[model samples]
Target: MSFFTSNRFQDRQAAAAEARKAMAEKFLSRPKYDPNDPAVKEREAKRRAVLEARAAREVERERRRAEAAAAEAARLAAEEAARIEAVRQEALARDAAENARRAEEERLEYERKLDRDARYAARKERKKKAKSPFERYR
Candidate 1:
């Protein structure tokens, strides 16, 4: 088993060395370019222009997205403010109605008390009149 394992490791190392050699040869065989060549310069300029255009488009898109977000936020804030104002108005109206009801109840109670006092006074006056002259002398 040990011998087989050592043999497998050596085989893997040999294969890796062969792969590196092949990669190096392939890289060297690729076409070389001259920096001063007009074709090379043109290709570089085209690539740079494309990259700049893409960046500009991205910036514009981001600006529009930010504007949209701000508009949405403002709209939501306005809606919330309107809702709050409506609630406040409703509360005020409720309070006014409650006050009116209380006032009406107090007025009714006062009127009933006045009626009872008048009836009591009339009864007392009748009793005094019913007493005769003899009762008054006693």
Candidate 2:
């Protein structure tokens, strides 16, 4: 037969109940005011000291980490600023070059127009000086 349905199961239950009762009685018999004992006090003080030391170490570690992160951030920011300034300078130089090229082209066109006007005026003057035969008789 399965142990769960056997007579031995009753004996096991009884033994388990007795064990639980014994454990409860032992727990109740422990001294309640042991905190003032020398050994307990020394152990508590040592634990607190260890906890304080760990806290101090953690704080120092965090401070160093924060400083390192800030330094890295500042370095990155400086690099970005330098890159932006370089790009701005390049754009300014390009714009100045474009303006200079446009000014040169305008100057060349003006010079050509002046030469054409002078040629046209000379041609008109020559035609006016040469008159027809009827005009000479009059």
Q: Which candidate number would show the highest lDDT if scored against the true structure?
A: 1
What do the candidate models score in CA lDDT, each in turn?
0.95, 0.95
Backbone atom clashes (below 3 Å) for every candidate: 0, 0
Q: What is the lDDT of residue 27 in candidate 2?
A: 97
What are the RMSDs of all candidates, in order?
A: 4.3, 3.8
lDDT tens digits, residue span 1-138, model 1? 676655677899999999999999999997799889898999999999999999999999999999999999999999999999999999999999999999999999999999999999999999878879888789
Q: Which stretches of candidate 1 lie over 4 Å from their true place?
A: 1-15, 31-33, 133-138
lDDT of 1 at 4: 62
> Would you list the clashing residue pairs of candidate 1?
none
